[model samples]
Target: MLEFALLVTALMFGGTTLYSFGFAAFVFTALPAETAGPLIRRAFPYFYLFVLATSAVAAILLIARDPISSASMGVIAVTTVFARQVLMPAINAATDSGDKSRFKRLHTLSVVITLAHIGCAAFVIIRLAGQS
Candidate 1:
């Protein structure tokens, strides 16, 4: 029962991370610069605040629950790293674009971060599946 609960929690966290990433990517890539300009300008403050809130809450939950097993820890670690190191940077880069070179550099960094995030998620998911 406890294992099942832990698995469910892990899956939920993983899904949340994926969902957030998907939304950010879609907003960044699909929306045109002009179209996204106002939207991003208006939304960024709220979005960042929300991200911070979520991160704090998640950290509290993880610390409290303190996943005893290795697999659980892996899931938490991967998701947390991806959120902080990858997704946040990607979103920031996507929102702030001024110069061509700056945009190019940020875009490249975002891609790299995204790919790393996906790889980490895949690895964690596979590990979780193997445990089941």
Candidate 2:
């Protein structure tokens, strides 16, 4: 279970890091802006869900072996919930309402939250590797 937890945590870390750093940029560069924007917006929910589920399970599995790591994962999971459920809809609403400033602000918030999640997942992975 510990090994599985570590694998999941590593996956979360790698997935987010890769997507944010490379894939998203490649996507926008390759696709038309109108198409890419909506496509990325559509993909965000699935990305958040992956973070939420993986982090939640990793936290549960880490609780006995490493309480602090577990708590960090929990924080990531909770933040993802907010990013997915609350912030996302608000962002979409701002876009629909043609409020460019509001959309940018909300989008920035979402990006920060995702980066924080990636950082937390990386911390957990480092801690786990140290234990190995």
Residue-level lDDT tens digits of model 1 in 19-125:
44766657768899677656655654454344344434433444434433333434444555555566556656655644557666765654564454445435544
lDDT of 2 by residue, 13-119 (tens): 98888889888898899999899889988898898888889899999999999999999999999988998899999999998899999999999998898888888
Q: Candidate 2 — which residues are off by over 4 angstroms? A: none
C-alpha lDDT values of all predictions: 0.50, 0.90
Who wins the lDDT comparison? 2
Model 1 RMSD, rounded to 1 decimal: 5.9
